[model samples]
Target: MERIEIENLAVQIRAARLEDAGIITRHRYPGEMGEHLAVYEDWLPTVFIGGVYLGWLAQSDGRVIGGAGLLLINWQPSRTDPHPLRGRVVNVFVEPDFRGRGVARSLMQTALAEARRLGLSTLNLGTSEQGRPLYASLGFQAAATEMWLKIKTEHGLSGDSPASNRIP
Candidate 1:
């Protein structure tokens, strides 16, 4: 890990590895912050080793303070984008104590650099209200017509009601 000083804070940024899967999974779930995807524990290691996902970690004093992940998805080349690969920026998180100190910004910059190096045509991310400003400042615009649907099957989604499936 090479040390980079951000706003007077010395932080080291490094590429994430398969051994870091457990820590990365915990950061993604963060108890009470979001829904826990139990399968991620098993899936991440495969992705990490398969080269489908590349991630960066920001550490200070030998402890992880922030991180970001870039997932490459295969897509058909369109007229607008001639590249067959698209990148999704995922699981960007910064510890509360490290916020507003350029940790997230550094992590994102690293992710973007990797995307460019990989020849990805477009990079996309889902951001919360609080994270919107930071992403917007990095040249990400609001994507129109984004929507999702949850299909109920035999397994069923816990506490899910039919009304909840409708797009608002």
Candidate 2:
């Protein structure tokens, strides 16, 4: 197979718009149920409300190749600390054809720059097995042991089923 020239691909990191919600959602979690789109659409407005930053579209001759972004995540106010400094690197995705090139690295660099610009003290992400190496090379260290427990609901859950364990 011919290689996609790294120099030919131009990544443009910009703020995500409402119209790009579908693409962003699908890119974030490929193979997810169609109904999940609603969840992202609902959150898009709020996510970008206080001006969440988003990276988008690695373009080559006007064809979009990949995208990534950093979101401004805020922890809930509590008695101990009213405000906390935290952020999340999310929606990081690259087109299959663009893999092996520097597209993802470029996107991540942009995201980190944005995080620093936003004055966030820490940034977090949950990565799949395939993504761990890439993240590790970028200086991200595995800190805590994350655990999850799922309980199946009766009547066979459908695409429209609501997620019960949502955080406030």
In Å, residue 41's CA in model 1 sits off its true spot by 1.2
Give the best candidate by lDDT.
1
Residue 24 displacement (Å), model 2: 0.2
lDDT of each: 0.82, 0.67
| Per-residue C-alpha lDDT of model 2 across residues 26-83, encoded as one tens digit per residue | 7776667765567776777676666765555456655556677677666765565444
**Clashing pairs in model 1, backbone N/Cα/C closer than 3 A:** none
Residue 19 Cα positional deviation in candidate 2, in Å, after optimal superposition: 1.7
Local error of candidate 1 at 23, Å?
1.5
TM-scores vs. true structure, each candidate: 0.88, 0.74
Worst 10 residues of 1 by lDDT: 159-168
